[model samples]
Target chain A: MEQPHGPQQQRPPSSPPVPPAAGGPAAAAADAPHAAPRAPRRLSRRRLLKLGGLVAAAGGLGLYRCGLYDERLLPPGLRVLGRREAAIAAAVIETVLPPEPPPSPERVRTLLAAIDAYLLGLPAEQVEQLRWLLLGVEHGTFWFGARLERFTRLGARGRTDVLTGWQRSRLGLARAGLRGLVALVFLAHYRDAPAFAAIGYGGPLAPGFAGPPASAARYARLLAPPEREPGW
Target chain B: MIYTAEHVRRDRVLQADLCVIGSGAGGAPVAWEAARHGLRVVVLEAGSYLEPRHFTQIEYDMVQRLYHDGAARTTADRAIHVLQGKGVGGSTLHNLNLCKRLPEEIAAQWFADHGLAPLQGGTLPALFAELEQLLGVSELGPAQANANNRVLERGCRALGWRGGWLRHNRRGCVGAGFCELGCPFDAKQNALKVFIAEAVEAGALVLADTWAERLEHDRRRVRAVEAAVRDPRTGAVRHRVRIEARAVCAAASATGTPALLLRSAVPDPYRLVGSRLFLHPGTAVAGIFAEPIHGWRGIPQSYECTEWLDLGPQSTRRVWIVPSFAHPAGAAATLGAFGAEHARLMRDYAHMAALSPMVHDLVPGRVRPRGRFGVAIEYRLDPSDAAQLRLGLVAAARLLFAAGARRVLVPASPALELAREDEIEPVLGALSLRPHTLDLTSVHPMSGCWMGDDPARACCEATGRYHHLDNLWVADTSLFPGSLGVPPQLTTYALGLHVGRCLLAALG
Candidate 1:
């Protein structure tokens, strides 16, 4: 039914080269529309194992990372995070979304509560991935594989450094988890009023209307349902 | 009467002259026209009737309620993020209300490739004009163009490119900027307001929270559409509803329509039923401005720069530079930055002006039906399409600089943060097509179930009738032969009208 050879696919037309601007790589890239496909950045299966293999090593040491979050300590809305997991999440988000004015204890509680609610509701697969990401972030190390210090144990600056390192890590798994957590935590914070206002966002399309909806009354003609024939 | 499946205590059997699946742009129009003609019509909508007053414009809430899988709909590989809408109004409820007719070249492509005679022969323009009048397609005025949109226009002027206001199906749009979320002010003339409302007024029975499992069809025609009435809050189905109809039109969407066909076990003679799908994968490059653009305050996507939008056959200049102002959750989802930089990006969310420089993609994809009421979309931005996005980012970065942006965040392979205007090219030029590097998001998903004269190459006829299944028709963007390089709401409406007319003729 199909041919494996020849120009079987219809390729998009090449654009007339964008007139180049002055600048080195960026300028050259300004005209960089159609380039040969480059190889995807990937860590081999061995590299991924190298990144996450630290959890088993910790298990060998009998340092249980499971149930790190305390359900009772979390705000009423939250059910998933244990005390330790909640603390580390709060710490991680503090670095990711550093609030401008120092937050009240209540403010911090609300943001964390919102995050807990979001995490608790994630679909089964995403929850698994989030948990895995949290474990890696909270436990993975700079030394070898995800086997570094517990993230909460690291200083504020150290936490930032560790997250950056993971972002820059060759292992795609580490990067995926890192990005996923950033999005989840980032959105969770923005959903809170204090955090939302900090970013200069106002919820709801401000009810600034010029007038009520006006139909051209295009269907006014069809209102009478004429007895005219529709046959062609 | 609108029936929610959850409260239906018994299996209900309903009948209509025409049964339309999905109540978005496609199904709503057909249902309206048929019901207007005094035909008994039944419309089945899987999503709930999320009315305007209930449209809490909060990004998180809207995504959970309106978007498919809470806007977490993705390709099978979880690479590209799909942004299809759900609910009685379908995606139109959350869509930005861009109502462009099929571009002339794309119309010709359909005629030549798919033998769509109606798209030619002066048929399409008349229908397009009809839709325009009905939907209130207006050229956005200067007042409606928000600061986010002005930034793109300013850049286009600075670069001497053809850029201006886009026409939208809005009546008194007060620039609420939450177009991705449902418009609370009822300013958007989505099908819920226009076609579906009219259809309901004309006595079309609309069933919400009812999921059509499959079409009961023989080799020649669909017998009855079997659906489950469901609780809007819970997935529990309380009753079953069977709608026996003279004709069935699948307008569920580019993804849902084909899935319905496959679920019905409809014969695919050409083996092209759910193949060769096209979605315009877009990537937004954010620019931090010194001035408080407050990009979220006004109408999102009012202006566009079409300088490099070349959609001719085999042409690579396939990019549309459009304004993209995002609500918090929407903005954070496809943001390419991670870690502290992502946090910093959010910090400047107020000053962030983004341009969704999207690519006109041609690489085809597939939509596979998964678990009950679930579908898996598989699409990839091939190297060429990825290359198109790379150039789009370059143009966007320059536009930001021209618009007096302090810094631009380029979501490139080696994502660049350029402060100086001169850094746009070298930084981008140095980057290669790390194929999976782009944060691809698409609102326009088109061309899965194609229409053509040939039975082998195309799935259905230009008349919108399924070739193998006689009485089943398609009335959605899925019938499109290729990408239209523009917002497709108007085209979808006209296609629905065309199909409805054809069906009327066939029934007579």
Candidate 2:
């Protein structure tokens, strides 16, 4: 065995030790005058998942280069969801909603805007969980749906298939991930007034009452004055 | 008087005889009673103060404004949806106002099993009567049943199942059909419009948009309460508030109360603070009728069928059925389909009626504090409870069919669509009770910091006093020894009053 690098440099052993790198401890050992020949290494599940993650990230980067994930698509002053996450969310909205009469570009943007507004009210921890959920759904296509493309790149039928796979998967995480995204989509889509007209909902029951205010100034005006002054 | 984050310019301090952590059904009465006794009281509410004028009656907007976690708070595994409310009045701001007393059987069970004698005592009934008078609890006539409630009523009559109209805490209800989204017409006589108002009039200072961080305690005595007043739009901590009080009451709901206790690190040798959580988990069944049901037009839930509900600990049937409908957003999210199929179902929105079977679970779940102001709920359905729910689903389908529904849709994965009565049994019989297989939501989350004689098994005494800490008390549904197999708002109000008196005596 090789005695180079002063007794292997005391490196922590990997699960299945990484294949020797050039000028590394294992490589130094292999290249030693008395070292034995090395055998072929087999890949483990953990290693495969790491590799998948890198490959998915690379695929995402490639899609970004293609201008699919435009950060400017998100409106200014978004407190939570990132631009890439918003793009993925838009794709999800397109996939789950009715395809016969496709949603207009403006409608999709409105839904995304509503989600962004909604996320502003949640705690950062929950919003962080949501970001992780989006990442999993985007990169999990190969693992869950046996597709190599990211979620945003998966066309309508492919995306549908992937979502169906998650909905029926034995793993609870997969089912929950799909459910979280679908809930977000429905929440934004069905709240729009156009959706009401399509479904025959007569909107709010009150006559002179307006819906949610469009600006902060309007919301302030809507708040009623306090009943009495504070004792302090 | 009330204050929000906007009213505070910098970190401030207050000295009070009593400090209440919430302004809900539980905390409001306590504040009112204590303030009336000339005790300087300060109340901290985590949500913003939005009166009737602020209520938009829009599902998305109100859900974000009034509900806990934008009504997106669910179990850790995403198995069940938990709908808790935030705001000056807590859940009462958005609750349907269905007021039911704790079942007699449940009270007996608590006394027998948990040694909760006070719950089964004579004092509680008087408290209930008084609370009812104050809140104007009354029953709607049979004529008040809209097409949605009528479906349940007609079905119960046709099948000879026990059912009737329930009482509510509303004084000027206008059938706006937007009770779940706070009442825009100021119809609901909830804690906000009733007790909290009275408390403010009695000089209790309520600080909305204030989040309680921890109870500064010295082993047995809670010395002070530390909190942060957050900017409403950005959720940033704009001001800090510290209150030194003789006593502190935690009226944050089941989830909120337990999380607060755990965060405060109150002495609990048994680790019983956040354990024993029970969610009255429920799922709905939709029926499509030839006549337009227009289900979302009147009081959301007024009538209920109790054939399957018996509040005994060992009872076989444990589901309470009520007419459940949703606005467009909730409907699209709950219905079991997507794309063209879901769109087709939405077209029949006006012709659809719904019935939800809420289970009275026996097994307990848990709640843990996630961060400073967040909760992590871990709840899974017990097999027995799930079986009862399945049975309730079958019964709901039968009722809808009996009421002349053209087609009944059970909101299950591969949603069971039954056209005839014969199709109900075999279809739902084979349906699995797994998490993703059926859609479930819970409005009532109770009994996390439960009350009992055994300190090892309970978080508080029957009088809402914490055993480990003398000056700390939990006065919300967190004090329930077991699941209250009914809407718990009315009992919550009564218990709040009881705990207030207990604290008043302790202070004296």
Candidate 3:
């Protein structure tokens, strides 16, 4: 089955072209032996209309089955992964990014739901590729998960350890994928959630972090450090 | 019972010793100064104050939340895309934090030509010293620099093009390389953290989501300012506030300040109020390398080329090449077209390091009032400026190739690509630098409302006070009499500080 290109699809060369009836007025005057005869004049207009309708219906059905109506038209399932893989992936992300104080389990669940929705919306071919990518993550996490689960479900400290290890090994590809997925999840949650407000993180939030404070007292504090106490 | 002010419904009057409008680079500092001087300063910001914690690590949301019109605002001719910040910190909140002082030569030119004698040698040095100390401008170390920047440095060194570390107003910057998205780490120093926060703490009353409409003048003096306050979240009309001050400063930036004055009909017979606009047009060159550059993992811009600044006429627009990385959507939009080929490019995201060279030209644009309070700008790039753009593009392409770019994309119509070193010049030479064929944008916009000795040629006087109006003053980039040839932030701050002192003396 051929995939549909944007708006300009070409027909196969084998298809016959529709021509005017041969052996009619002009055809008869320049007639050669190969000129075909005209169709019978007795055919009704209703019959012609019925035939056209049938052709249109057939074409529409063909286009629909070829994924013209659906964005994701998968080729073949490479593997049948278990829900446990997805769950384990979520557990790892949570471990890597421990929720801050006002922690809401709802936020995590919402984020997961959003990621699933985004994945479902992707093209079938892309979805297949992404699933493969996720499998790579699953493989890497399998051994790590067992050891992590054995020790307090991997807090921020443990997550940092895993991240640092990955960085030192120069696993940039895996890190990019993980970062992309995490960013997407975080964005979806922020946009969908009503309780949160967008923050100005990039450009100019504050003056130079190391510059003298606007206030004299604050400036002085920046220069001084907390005093060390005697050991008890 | 529902009440109505003289002009608009749902009105309330607020009083303060000084009322500052717009809370970005300019107003933020002015408010801080006034409040610190024991004056009751009220800052009216058109955008909301967003906290750092609320900033997401995503590109799309970051742009939508931080950028003006989600980074879609442009000139009427669409020759240049202008990205401004709308939230509390303003454009400072979304800037790359490239802080550099205005060149001395440019300062001297303004002083001699425009009669801005105050900005002469000795005075200029003192002002710059104060500005630098206040802003904490410094250079990024090798550890803070990213691999992407190193590629530019390597290319410049190989080709013998001068380059050095770009100074930035930052401290404790971990180099996340997300400066364009608003620094989540609070490392990039913007006015909000330094000036605005300090001002608020110093007893300045900042009213977010309030837009000043028109000035209420009594003959030759501005008696008060009328504004419409709205809830930023819902866009619902909250109330109308009237602020009365002995001095009124319009620090609403290049675009906003001009629109305000034009709406108030502040008499400019010269018709130069919103004219002589200069935008440092820039374009980027992306290089794909074999090794993982991880461009997004380091500083967004840590290096630049100063050698190009003194390049003689006919030399292409010179600029310091800096490293940059965008969010996925932005990356995709810039990368152009989506498919398996695009996906392969994404796979090598770690290998891509980008450099943008910005050019300065004397070609001026004008801003006209649209309706009553809005503004519509018209810009036309001169032939010489166009040539400079082409020159910059060619030079950037060569540098990328020298740095071993497997593939380079030039952001122009009929986008040219170079795979080999030999094909670089031919591809760049074949390109047209016409205004319509190229994609140009500006982060720094100055000289829309100029200050000069002659009111006939300038919008305001040397003191930044409007020609006819006694107490009305302009304290933003709009007061820049001409192009500073470098970043305008330091000059703007210095001039603003000078204007404040002048206002104080006059009032006394």
Against the true structure, candidate 3 reaches a TM-score of 0.68
Which docking band does candidate 2 fall into? acceptable
lDDT of 3 by residue, B1-508 (tens): 0011112235667677777888777777777777788887777777666555445545545665676544545677545667677667777878877777767666666767789765565875786687677778887766677788888888888899888888888877766666777766767678877887777667776666677888888658888988877654334456778888888888888888888877777766777778777777766677788887767666777777665565233435445445555544454445432223234455566677787767776677878666534467788777777766677776777777788889887654323567887887787777766554555777778877888888887877877788878988887888887655567777777777777666656666
- Model 3: what is its DockQ? 0.02
Name the top TM-score candidate.
2
TM-score of every candidate: 0.83, 0.89, 0.68
Query: How well is each residue in B247-276 modelled by candidate 1, as lDDT tens digits?
Result: 999999998888888877899976787887
Tens-digit per-residue lDDT, B352-402, candidate 2: 999999999999899999988889999889899899889899999999999
DockQ of each: 0.10, 0.30, 0.02
Where is model 2 more than 4 Å wrong at Cα? A1-77, A143-146, A207-231, B117-120
Candidate that scores best on DockQ: 2
i-RMSD values for every candidate model:
8.6, 5.2, 18.3
lDDT of 1 by residue, A1-232 (tens): 3333212123335745434577799556534655443444577898889867876787755554443443333455457776666776776666666535544456556668876665543344555556667766776755323435567666667777777767666554455456556666656656646657766787654433322333323322222233421111
Q: Which residue ranges in model 3 land beyond 4 Å of their true spot?
A: A1-232, B1-10, B233-237, B311-320, B371-373
**Candidate order by lDDT, highest to lowest?**
2, 1, 3
Any runs in candidate 1 off by more than 4 Å, and if so which? A1-60, A67-73, A77-95, A99-147, A150-162, A171-177, A205-232, B5-7, B234-238, B336-343, B412-415
Residue pairs with colliding backbones in model 2 are none
